[model samples]
Target: MTQITAAMVKELRERTGQGMMDCKKALNAAGGDIEKAIDDMRAAGSIKAAKKAGNIAAEGAIAVKVADDNKAAVIVEVNSQTDFLALQDDFKGFVSDSLEKAFAAGYTDAAPLIADQESAREALVAKCGENVNIRRLARVEGDVIGAYLHGHRIGVVVTLKGGTVELARDIAMHVAASNPQFLAPSEVSEEAVAKEKEIFMALNAEKIAGKPENIVENMVKGRINKFLSEASLVEQPFVKDPEIKVGDLAKKAGAEVISFVRFEVGEGIERAEVDFASEVAAQLEASKK
Candidate 1:
C-alpha cells in the first residue's frame, strides 16, 4: 500500500468534509489512492443520505431570479433533510441553477420540470447526498414577471399585463409576505367554501338561531361573504396596508395583477417523521463497539 501520510489524510478530509479519522480509514481502505478514496467517501455519504431520506426537509430556503430585459422570472425551492444543508453554499447555488434551468426550458408545469431537474440534482446528491431535492420550480412569462425572495422557504412570482416594473416588484414582494391560496374568488373550490361555511355555522349556530329564520339566513350570508373576502387574494386586506384591499391597492398603484404563484417550500409535500432521540441512541450503541 502507498504511504498514508498526514498530508494525504488532510487533503481527503478537506475534499469530502468527512472526519479526519474517517478520511484516513477510507484512504487506507483504498490503498492510499486519494482519488479512489474520494470515491469511497462519496459513496459512503450517499448511503448516509439514503438512510435519512425518510426525514422531512419541510424547511428550506426560497429564492427568485429574473431574466434579462426583465420580462420573465423564476421561483424555486431546494429542500434538504435538514436546514443545515439548506444554508450551505452548494445547496443555495443548486437552487439558483435549477431555477435558471426552469426558466430556460419555459416550463410552467411542476412535474416535467422536476423530471428534467432530477439528473442534475442527483449529481449534487453524489457530493452532498440524497438530502437534496428540487422540490418545486415555477416560471412566468407574460407582459412582465417579477420576483421576490423572502429569506428562504418563501418565494413569489407575480405576473402583470401592463404595469410599471416597480409596481410588479412590489406586488411580488407582497405575495412573498402574504401567501394567498388562490388568485381570485372564482378559483376558490366550492368544497372549500362549503367546508368553511359549515364550520362557521357549527360554531355560531346557537347565537345566530335566537333571531328569526330570515335574520339567521342573512347572518349566514354575511358570514359566507366574510369568508370570501378573507380567502380571496384581491379581496383580502393588503398586508402592506390593511386599510385597503389588495385589488384596490393594485388599482391605486396603477397595476393589474395578472396572476401570481407562491410556493412555500414543502407546503403540501408529506414529510416523513424522525425520532432524533432513538436515532442518537442507536448511533451511541454503534460507537461503543
Candidate 2:
C-alpha cells in the first residue's frame, strides 16, 4: 500500500479545494498519485473544477503587438518572481521587447526569441535580485487580425476572415474577457465531451436514477450541449449584448472567426509558498551562533 503524505494532501487540497480528509481518502484510493486523485474526485462530483488561472500564484505580465496593416499579431508572456518586480519599468520593457522581436520575426515558438533576449533578461534579474523568464509566445495571421490587452495581465489575438478590423477588435476584446477554450462547437474534442458527460452524470446521479433509458440519454445529451455552448466562443453570449450569441454577432458583420490565442500571466505555473515567519526565526537562531 502506498503511504499518503501530508504534502500530497496539501497539494490535492490546493488543486481541488477539497477538505484535508477527503483529499487524503482520494489520494489513498489513487495510490498517492495527485493527478489521478483529482480526476477521481472530479468524476465523483466532489470537485466541480480544478484550479484555474485565477488561482495561479505566479506573477507576470502579458504583451501583444499588432501589425500596421492588421494582418498579423503576436502575444507574449514574461514571468517574474514577484508582482513588485513585474510592475517595474525594466521588467515591462523586457516584456515589450520580447513581444516586438517575436512579432518582427513572425516566430510562433518562444525558444529562439527567449535565447535572443537572454542577456537582457539576465541583466534585469541581476538588477532586480529576482528570477525572470520569457515564458511563451504565439502569433496569428489572417485577413484581419485584432489584438487586445487587458491591463498587461491578459492578452488576446483574434483572426477573422471577411471581417472588418473593428469587428475583429470587438471579438478580441470578447476573447480577453470570456477566455473561451474553442473557436466553435465543432472544435471541441470528443474526449472533452465524454468527460463532461461523466461529471454531469455523477453530479446528478440521484436526479437521474430509475429514469427510462431514453430519458436518461436525453438528459445526458442536454448536458453535453450546454457544456459545448459554454466552452465554445461562437456559441457564447456576446459580452456586450446578452440577447445575442457571438456567432450571431459575427454573422451580422459578415465575418467568421478563424482562430484566437489568449494568454494570462503565470497561467499553469505553480509557485512555491513561503513561510516568512519560519524563515525569520531561522535567521535569528543562526545569528546567535
Candidate 3:
C-alpha cells in the first residue's frame, strides 16, 4: 500500500478547492493517488452540495452594469438563504460573473440566462450549500439602459431612448420607488383591467344604485382606465415632478421609456408558514427527552 504523504494531499486540495479533511480522506481512500482523490472529492463534494437545493433563499443582492455608450445594460438578482451567505465572496463573485456573461450572451433574454438547460444554476446548488436563484433579470439594447439598486432589497432598470444620463437615472429611481409592474398603460392586460373594474364595481355599485346600464358601463371604464394608469409606469406621475406624467416627460425630453424592470427580493416567494403553538410543543417535547 502506498503511504499518502501530506504534500500529495496539499497539492490535491489546492487544485480542487475543497476542505482539508475531505482532501485527506480522499487521498487515503485512493491510496495516495492525487488525481483520483481529487476526482473523488469533486464528485462527493458536488453530491453534498446538491442536498442544499431545497433551502429557501429569501435574501441576496441585485446588481447592474451599464455599457460605456449606455446602449445596453445588464441587471440580475442572486438570492441566498441568508444575508450572511449573500455577502460571502463566492456568492457575490458568482453574481458578478453571471452578470458579465449576460452582457455578452448575445441578447438580454432572462430565460436563456437562468435556464439550467444551459446555465449551471441547478448544479450550483451543491457547491454553494444554499439555494441561489436568478430571481429577476433585465437587459436593454437600444439607446440607453440605466439602473439603480436601493440597498439589497430592491433593484430597478429603465430603458430609455434619446435621454441624458440624469434623466435616465432619475427614471430608474422612480421605478425603485413606485414598483409598477408594467411599463405603459397599453402593457396592462385586459384581464387586469377587467379585474380592477370588477373590484371598483363591487365597492361602489351600491352608492350608484339603479344607475342606467350605459352610465354604469361608463363608470367602470373610467375606473379601469385609472387603475391601468396607476399600475403602469409610463402613466404614473414623475417622482421628481409630480405635475408631469412620466410618459409625457419623456416625450418632452425628446425620448421614450422603452420599458423597465423592477425586482424586490422575496416579493414573489411564498414565505413558509409556521405553526407557532405546534412548534412550541415540539420544542418542549424535545427538551424533556
Of the candidates shown, which would achieve the greatest TM-score relative to the real structure?
A: 2
Q: C-alpha displacement of 5 in model 1, angstroms?
A: 34
Q: Write the per-residue lDDT of candidate 1 for residues 1-289, one digit (tens) a residue.
A: 6889998888777656678888888889999987677667657663222223234667677777788877877777777777777888888787877777777788765577678777677667667654576666667777877777777877787887777777777877877776777777888899988898799889997898678889887887888788778767788887777899878777787777889988787788787666899999999998997
Per-model TM values vs. the true structure: 0.74, 0.77, 0.75
Alpha-carbon lDDT, every model: 0.75, 0.84, 0.76
| Predicted structure 1: lDDT | 0.75
Candidate 1 lowest-lDDT run of ten: 46-55
Q: What is the lDDT of residue 163 in candidate 3?
A: 82
RMSD (Å) per prediction: 7.9, 14.9, 8.7
Which portions of model 2 miss their true places by more than 4 Å? 1-57, 275-289
On the 0 to 100 scale, the lDDT of residue 233 in model 2 is: 95
Alpha-carbon shift of residue 57 in model 1 (angstroms): 3.3
